[model samples]
Target: MNYKQIVQYGVLIFGAIILIGLVLKGNISHEKFDSEKWKNWTETESELSLRWDMMNSLRNNHELIGKTRTEIIELLGKPDSETKMDFRYYLGMSKHGINTGSLTIKFNENRIVTDFSVWQG
Candidate 1:
């Protein structure tokens, strides 16, 4: 074929490959959360943790709105850092790969979880 036709075909193929890659990445990022896997994922390197894969499931299935501090620790293990009002657990690399992500659980005066959020820094 002519040079113009060859170039057009190349561009189409490249675009299709990119679209497929995006679809696969999206699917991989939403893996179901498993408590056993989560507790055992103790990789020091944030990027290696299974927590990234399970994040969506944890947020959707687990109810952290009113759990006690003891319950939180029992479920999620010890936090990387904690304060009087909150605990932070490092999840893994952010979607952008420029920073790490963490789960922050907030508690009230009764030491019950009031809210929680996931963030990337």
Candidate 2:
């Protein structure tokens, strides 16, 4: 190819790489746990707001409760840890020196989520 054509192709390839990186970043950033939200959240805040966020999180992830292992992985990616009968995800958010909390999800032998708990640390 001519020098100019080669330059054009290089720019296009670079742009594609950058775009793919951004898309992957976006997916990772929108995890089942949102630490920044928790960091800013104070126990003293309105109960309504806290409940809202909690409910939203559950709503978004409730589908995993009954999904097969393969299905959950397709949607939420691989868990931090896994076993024959359970899966665990340790995740959370932090910002401005304040951390919201880490959330841990538990799944049952059926490969469906059974419960979740949170810890502020």
Task: Tell me the TM-score of each prediction against the true structure.
Answer: 0.70, 0.39
lDDT of 1 by residue, 1-121 (tens): 9999999999999999999998778536777887777777776654364787788788889899999999998888888899999999888765565566899999999999999988877
Write the residue-wise lDDT of candidate 2 on 1-121 in tens digits. 8999999999999999999998766233332444344334444534223423453464565654566777656544565677676555443433213555444556676667666555555
Worst 10 residues of 2 by lDDT: 26-35
lDDT of 2 at 99: 50
| Model 2 error, position 13 (Å) | 58
- Per-candidate Cα lDDT values, in order, are 0.84, 0.54
Candidate 2 positional error at 63, Å: 2.5
Judged by whole-model lDDT over C-alpha atoms, candidate 1 comes out at 0.84
Winning candidate number (TM-score): 1
Residue pair clashes in candidate 2: 35-93, 38-100, 39-100
